[model samples]
Target: MWSEIIGKFKGMPSQEKVVRLLLERGFQVDGQGHVVSGRIEIPHTQIAREVGVDRRVVDATTEMILKDDILKRVFMNIHSIASFKDVAPLLGLGVIIITPDNAQNIGILNDVTSVISMFNLSIRQAVTDDPFFTDEPKMTVITNDVIPGELVSELRKLKSVKSVTIQ
Candidate 1:
């Protein structure tokens, strides 16, 4: 919602990155959104370039997002973008979970489960609290779709799986 601030620094390099990063971090749509690093400062153009878009596009995106009644309500304060970093994927209309383990497992799980689960989902960090060392070895899974209980029951039948509990 920092569309005005973004518009003020329009045409600057990495403009998209600054606004996107800020929005991702949870800053609201307002002048206060400009106050990121303890001051009303604009980020360098490199940020926009890194995100592969110019500043104007980022500004426009911010404005469009701010106009939404839902977004305005969600980010009431022009807080730092850092707060919203965890919120974007949620906008994808799917459930998400954090495992804190290997990114690869999450990837594989997607391929395996996408067919069964009709919902669109994406994965990042492992959702398992301890993907590595648990009471026993553990694996984390993130999915937007619901898996059939029978599948889980079948997997637990494997010898390698000590126990199955959906965290």
Candidate 2:
């Protein structure tokens, strides 16, 4: 599905970057070509500065996205999530980051979560990076209690897991 969406921006690298940034950040391109996060409007200049493109490029990208029915539908419905990985300790939560040997491999999440569950840890949140969007995709699980070393070791032993970090 992502490949198909990206295909539309083929040969247009600036537009591709804009689209990728929008998707990664869950920023929406409205029918009127405004870039927004929920009700907050994001200025084209800001998006262009972040993406290293001109403000006109951001405007054109949003215009193109709004003009396409498929892109419009996707952008309008996408949203950002609040991930707990960075502030887990501050919030008195446990965070486990798993780097998969092969992110596309099946059962990685299930296997890791099974081990976590075996330790009787209640998961507060789980966020997985989309392989298509991120170069170093990882799975972050937030638990109610600090994750034990035993659980981390078990997670590392999973067939799909390459490394595990508990914090």
Candidate 3:
């Protein structure tokens, strides 16, 4: 569905760059065709710079999204999420990064979390990148305390996990 949504701007490569940036950052196109994060408007210049496109290209992309009902609905409701991956270690929290052999594999999150629970470690947050959007999607789990070596060993042993990094 995301591919189809983005494909809408297939003919316009500049607009496609804008759309990919918007989707990756969870930025939304408001009714007035403004790029926004919740109620806060993000300058079109910033968006344009991020995607290396002209400001007009960002404006046109939002305008196109607003014109389509499906795109408008999705973008209107989209908002950015705060990731704890950067701050976890500073806050003395455990950070576990699990790169799966295949992001499409189901139960990766459940399986990883189940193992963490077995060690009585509480999860602060679990976030996974969309496989379709990312070249290599990995799951980052922030736990209440530093992950034990035993847990890391166990996680690495999971059949679905390609690699496990404990921080």
For each of the candidates, the C-alpha root-mean-square deviation to the true structure, in angstroms, is 13.8, 0.8, 0.8
What ranking emerges by lDDT with the best candidate at the front? Answer: 3, 2, 1
TM-scores for every predicted model: 0.30, 0.97, 0.97
Weakest 10 consecutive residues of candidate 1 by summed lDDT = 92-101
- Which pairs in model 3 have colliding backbones? none
* lDDT scores of the candidates, listed in order: 0.44, 0.90, 0.91
Please give the clash total of every predicted structure, in order.
19, 0, 0
Name the better of 1 and 2 by lDDT. Answer: 2
Native-referenced Cα lDDT, model 2:
0.90
Q: How far is candidate 3 from the true structure (C-alpha RMSD, Å)?
A: 0.8
Candidate 1 lDDT for residue 55 = 54
lDDT of 2 by residue, 38-84 (tens): 99999999999998999999988888888888998999999999887
lDDT tens digits by residue: candidate 1, 55-99:
566565556546655544544554532222244345432223222
